[model samples]
Target: MTPAGRATGAGRVFPPLPQHPDPQAPFATSWWGNAWIGALEGTSLDAGRLARGRAYAREGHVDTITVAPGRIVAYVHGSRPRPYRAEIRMRTLTPEDWDNFLDAVATEPAHIAALLDKDMPHALVDAAERAGVQLLPGPGDLVPSCTCPDHGRPCKHAAALTYQTARLLDADPFVLLLLRGGDEQALLDELAQRNAHQAAREQSATTPGATGESLPGTLARDALATDYRPPLPAPLPPPAHPGEPPLLPSLPGAPNPTSLEFLATDTANRAHAYLTTGTAPFPTADPWHDAVRLAASHPGLTGRRSFSRQFAELARSVDHTPTDLSRAAAAWRQGGEEGLSVLESPWDPPAGPFDRARGALITADLPRMTIHHNHLTNASGSLQLRYGRDGRWYPYRSEPGRDDWWPEGEADADPVGAVTGMIGS
Candidate 1:
């Protein structure tokens, strides 16, 4: 009944789950899938985005999704020609948490069957929580990021992808485990070992005066000397597709049944993938990038008027300010991970479009321009052109008495033309 903390699997890319054909049909058919939707909706600060995201999911805007330990990534199309990349990330469980969860499951054989059948009872969940294992996402657990410029904690595109993810969970609960850290086969394998040890201990217990030191066991070296032992079982095959999310029984005082089911569905899918492929997902290489990503996606940092207290304490712990967070957050809103890299890592672009744009700006003869590392600014410092490592131009306008900046213009490929267009606005 406890949410197993340590699910085991590497990352896997999943094809987009089919959009429901009927408009009137519910987005999530199974109880588990509904639970996933509930977590997303309940945590989101912006109702408008949730509504739009639901609409987008129904219309089939989300692209192929990649699920890995602690993260979900996909592309969602909106008003633009290019689909925006969106991702949601959560914290994985610690080793102790996994040990406790697996131990709990082993204590009751039915729990194992319940998971295999894609259902987790509230009793197990309560047991897990009692032991300090959080099986389902609560508010602020979901950290959302997007390449689009919208400043919403989860913009419409991210929301849409999140909505679609619920269906994937409905199809397979193992995906939830994958979200945590372990895959289906790995967990099962561990459970099987526990069962074996338990049986051995029971046999030893029945023996008269059998102490711990008197337990019957053979050394691996001795066993290897003989060849009569049975062969190991064959590797497990992957599920044809991730199965449907398991159901949690409805009961009074039970945790949100839907949310548990949603996680169950997600866990099932991940287990399926791990069974098929032995490969595991790896974490991103850059530590700095990861930190910035957390800051940008913090639920409290969504807007000027809206802030999460949790995010505030987190920022202070890391010695960062809201202004610093906003500056990087805005850059992330524009360019995702790359924008953060560009914001601090100054690099001089080779002479090409940047040079051409400078010439064009000079030709206009509006004001004397000063050039610094990757930046072109007028004498008044009101208008500036900051070039990215990728050769794309990001325009920034200085605010009176404020050091921070926001992107003002569009059409970055043609920096000169873009400067003429939105700088005036």
Candidate 2:
């Protein structure tokens, strides 16, 4: 059949795969991409047509693919002289679904971070599902059609295009999002606006008597003028002796004689090196240690107090409890380097969890799985199967325990089934 030129659509165009001089695998490397191909293969009634489609994909028959909201268009080279035009269409989420999904995304900061990093975290997918949004396509969700003589619902031409599209999805998850009815930039902008609005509301709620209104112009101006500026400093008198060195002030509160002595010795050494070699002192890499050193060398009560308050704020930002910070502080006071070392080391988990998980997998006759820390990782690194406290397996897209695991459907109780479902069979 002779036809016209390339297929055109109102969406982004993905260039055709480069011709492989040698035959290559048609399947996608990413699990999500494989899942898409799986849906296509599983839904087709004829295995022969599916096989032909895979061959066509492997041979690089599909031309540039166009993807838009709810639709995909492509040109596939067939037995005939002219390439056939193929199109695959999926149901786009409704406006209400998008709203619910966006709301769910707004509830978690990690969702935005993951998306920005080009990762689609399973936790975000679970949240969307809970919000009544189906981010991933299920069976029958994709409908394929091609302008070819073959009467098959998705002829080899269309199937080849679908398989190629999966490869595209594997490279860029945003393509999947765009297919679901969201423009990438628009989605990010909306998320940013929502987060900013939420922050403003929270700030207003926390402020006492905040009415969300600006003060009267004249009163606001007068208040700002009175409180915003600091008094100018007076000029200091000349030195009493031009040749004599200046005296330094004594530090207040004494601040542990041992710490002070170390500070004095270290500071003098650094000062001498700087003067002799014209080199600057190296800054401490650890913020906590730097803070302690600064506090130790501080000249007076005010300086020490400022550094102490700053250190406390830093600890709070890292989620350290008051007791934890106090213990670390005490360690610093007793033996500076040794105490910090104790605080910085990560605690080891008991071997019981790993042993139990391994035993379960062994009993299930899946001995190929490699154990890593509290999780089992596959060779591809796409699936992370974690052992939970409830004696069940959890599949995570990221590091286990860093975020919620992906939800298991019918295969929840079966560890092997869960792993297969996550990364595909």
Candidate 3:
């Protein structure tokens, strides 16, 4: 069924939409109050984000739209996009014009209703059709539901959007044309022509060029013409980046399995081997399986988080009394796999606060984990590692409170030798 048309008074000025208050608000009335309402129908259906909605958007889920013929479609979010069988023939209006119309309505509701009951405009219908507003072809109510705290098909956010869009429709009326398909300027021009024709009929027998006005004369009066000027190009600034560990040299006291030149050379050799022999030089696990296993081993490293070089300071602060403890401390100062390996693997059940046999690596349940040559400690500290999915490696830390294993005295000791002895023991 066709909806009633809205009328615009000749010479009435259409005001702009309201300004948005918070720039960061996820959903704002102003943002959703745009002319292209149907474009938003399928945007909320991002599968990746919706799959992990709880951990991702915190609680908000998405809604889908139902498309139909010759009517503006309704959209709401939930498990899936559903159709609201009931049809609402709609029109859009600018917020400013809408407010003015509402004020006039409040002053005289009967007059507004009478005009709404009048014949609908062809321009509006054509524009609305072009905008892709259509009756959704479906059987049931299209309720948007989210797995988030909001249980209904449409949350407060979507509902607010719906109500606000409706209110915008009650104003300037051309916004409805904009919603239907045409831009604001286009609709306004059409309406302006209609007004001009009516005025011409009312004042018949007028000759052309009676006013002798031209477009350029009007353009001369425009604010843009008065303010027009070219801008100067600014100077380019030097690139600056954050403080990071030196990749090539590594750091003083850091682990170095081999020189970078050697490692790069080895990687190049491996690539050549793969290219020539058609065999993988390095053992590559399935990314998904590797990520799952890596996650299980650490259990805590879920998101894109990193750790800094605070462990170095902690190591420097420890005091040594006994000779064995002194040796462990010196080994720790050396900062590498050899130093940390001297610190015994932290047992699943640690013996003391400073267990001679248990360290961070042992407690973190690191299994068959390859320590990079640059890792600060192999046994007890954080590991800057990567997941299978991400492009780069990040830092992972052991759970706090349980501390034992690497001692100040064992820092300088041969941890690999100690581990070998343990294998024998």
Please name the candidate that would achieve the greatest lDDT relative to the true structure: 1
lDDT to native, each model: 0.69, 0.63, 0.32
- What lDDT score is found at residue 181 in candidate 1? 73
Assess candidate 3 and give its lDDT: 0.32
lDDT of 3 by residue, 1-425 (tens): 01112332111112222433343543223322332233333434443432332221223221222221112222222332221111223233444443333333323334333334532333433333344433111212223332235543334334433333333444435344433333434333444454555556555557654564443645545747666587878854422321111123225887651233233434555566566566875454533222222222221121112211221222233332233333333333333333323232322222232232235336544323443332232344422221111111122233333432222211213333333333333
Task: Return whichever of 1 and 2 wins on lDDT.
Answer: 1
lDDT ranking from best candidate downward: 1, 2, 3
Candidate 1: TM-score? 0.49
Ranking by TM-score: 1, 2, 3
lDDT of 1 by residue, 38-155 (tens): 7787777889998888888888888778787788877676775345668888888778888877787777778778788877666666767777888777778888888777979788
Error of 3 at 222 (Å): 32
What's each prediction's TM-score? 0.49, 0.47, 0.24
